[model samples]
Target: MTAARLISVNVGQPRDVELNGEIKQTAIFKDPVPGRVKVVDHHVDGDRQADQVNHAGVHKAVYAYAREDLDFWAAELGREIEDGFVGENLTITGYDVSHAVVGERWRVGGVEFEVAQPRIPCWKLGVRAGDKSMTRRFELALRPGAYLRVVAEGEVGAGDTVEVLSRPEHGFTVADASRIFHRDRAEAARLLAVDELAPPLKQWARKRLGLELEEEGG
Candidate 1:
């Protein structure tokens, strides 16, 4: 298979905006950055996450969306969706990010990242796109992007080569994680099998499988 490559490096700061008569703070609006940017252990430099409770952590240091997926959405939405429009830190090409397995390691430029989980579509996605139905559409499409944990922090830029260094044996793909996240109980076993999944995701899978409470009390 051809090597995946970074098509764009995007970043954004948190800002407040009005959504459905409520003032909400979000970092969903991102723009592509020029030149190389520092990839920190926790996040990309100049990037911010407004909802720390749900985003921007060591397990989700960088979010990546495939250019092909963007193209599909562009055709479906009847408008050109630019890179970073979906709040991704990296717009990538030549990889089926939605199908990437948890624990898969990717070396890009001088940095290394591990696939952590699939990005769960939130209301902010709809709010940013100016369509309340966008979140539902995104869910139905099942093209949710991937979030990566920084394994080795360094600098990266657009056009950087991305090579997969390893893949987990558990066979739990990001799409499987996304399905479990959306309450598809059938994927619980596969979700639980992935040891590299973030803690919150593991807890969620356990809860869905009726194991969390049992395990916690023990």
Candidate 2:
């Protein structure tokens, strides 16, 4: 396999954006930052999540998107896709973020991270894209990037190599998790057995399997 490397490291501060008729706080407009940046408790030193309810937490800490995926979208959108265009903290290349195993561990520079889950586009994504239909477009794109949890906080920067430390024996990937959450009960049943699956996704799978209610879901 070709080595994977960090293309860019990005972060953003919350900004007021006009959505529909009201102003809303969003941090989806991330820009690449030069030099090394520390990975703190749950995010990069200069990054902050605007909405905590659905974004930014231990399990959804560092978002990573593949540069190849961005290239695909750029061609589709008839424009150049910038690094961190979709709010990802790390823009990577060579490794497929969407296919990353859910429990896989990787090290970039001095930081260690675990694959946590796949991104689920929201209205904030549309706001960032400047298109009301972007959320739906992204969902259909099937290139949903992966979110990672920090295992060992340290610093990272552009050109840093992404090194895989270990991986679960099971083949449960971010794409499978995304599919289960979106619409596949059978797949959910199979993947729920993977002990290393992210807890939030496990809860969601249980709810999908009728073992819990939506209110009890993650």
Report the Cα RMSD per candidate: 2.7, 1.8
Candidate 1 regions with alpha-carbon error over 4 angstroms = 213-218
User: TM-score, each model?
Assistant: 0.94, 0.94
TM-score of 1: 0.94
Q: What is the C-alpha lDDT profile of model 2 across 21-79, one tens digit per residue?
A: 99999999999999999999999999999998689899899999999999998897889
* lDDT of model 2 at position 25: 97
Collision count of model 1: 0
